[model samples]
Target: MKAVLGPFVPSYTGPWLAGVDEVGRGPLAGDVVAAAVILAPDRPIEGLNDSKQLTEKRRELLFEEIQGSAAAWCIARASVAEIDRLNILQASLLAMTRAVQGLARAPEHVLVDGNRLPQWEYSAEAVVKGDSRHPAISAASILAKVARDREMVAFDEQYPGYGFAGHKGYPTKTHLAALEKLGVTPIHRTSYAPVRERIEQIELF
Candidate 1:
């Protein structure tokens, strides 16, 4: 598939353009993680794709390679408290902005994976499905996904029985069942309907 697909082409070929992407917007728990990556024109890595399209093993492999090869990369997140306060879309944009701003080298332009660009000083374009089409965005997606997945795995160990490691805090059948039996945790976004309903149930009890 990769051979037929060939390599990803950047929308803008500027030396310092960064790609930004966020993960964990739909999950009932955990922070919204985002990543920004500035790819070195001279140092290109293979197998870049939308994180969702790649296998866990492939994503993990690319995750390491991206960090090593990219000109600049940073991972950032908006906490559950921030998510509850600002709402998911805004929180996602906030996380993306933080990721971009946290980059070791400032970006000349940013290509974001979604249609909405965060309110920031840097020049940026929101390319719908940019992850599959652009190399830097693909790298950002992989990094954000891997980082958030690892954190969810850790949270699973800390909280237990919620299946966070498996579901990654998505409102899966197992996660919903666990929420009913084990109740919400500190990492859960209370503003989400399922979590909020669970809290209400507890309050009534």
Candidate 2:
């Protein structure tokens, strides 16, 4: 038999391959959301890039395009309660796993946009900064970010002074100050240091 060599190819470029990415991991409130997308080889979407690199308006536009063009796509989340119980990292992985499993059909391979892969049965690879490099991952990133941002905007109406609309549940100075002055809301992650400190202070009184 003759030895043969072939050029390496990224699995995400293959059929039935999914790219996964998450958003809202650093936020002090709201769930960590993840999205999985299996892009159609024939239907190439233009301007796919890291969701953070794009404006909100651009992401919104791409979000629709991805949904309409992808062969399979799903968005899933780990709640604040899950984050507190399992820790943020584990919860994020869980969210990603859920997103992959939620696809209309199982992916032959999964490319995750981070250094770690979730513990799951699917064949997967972890690609650092994959969102910028892979179209599927970028699509996933846009979906996760837009979904989570919209949720936080809705939370702003319910929580009022916390500025969830502006900060999107991140631990901004305004958010920290609101936590101290207005007290921790139910959406706030109690496992986080700032929220835990507030809870302790309330317990002492």
Model 2: per-residue Cα lDDT over 1-205, one tens digit each: 9644232247545689899999988989999999999999999999999999999999999999999999999999999999999999999999999999999999999999879989999998988788887888899999999999999999999999999999999999999999999998889999999999999999999
> Which ten residues in a row are the worst by lDDT in model 1?
1-10
| Candidate 2 wrongly placed segments (more than 4 Å) | 1-12
Candidate 1 regions with alpha-carbon error over 4 angstroms = 1-11
**Model 2 lDDT, residue 129, Cα:** 80
The estimated TM-scores of all candidates read 0.95, 0.94
What are the per-residue Cα lDDT tens digits for candidate 1 across 101-190?
999999999999888988989888898788888889999999999999999999999999999999999999999999999998999999
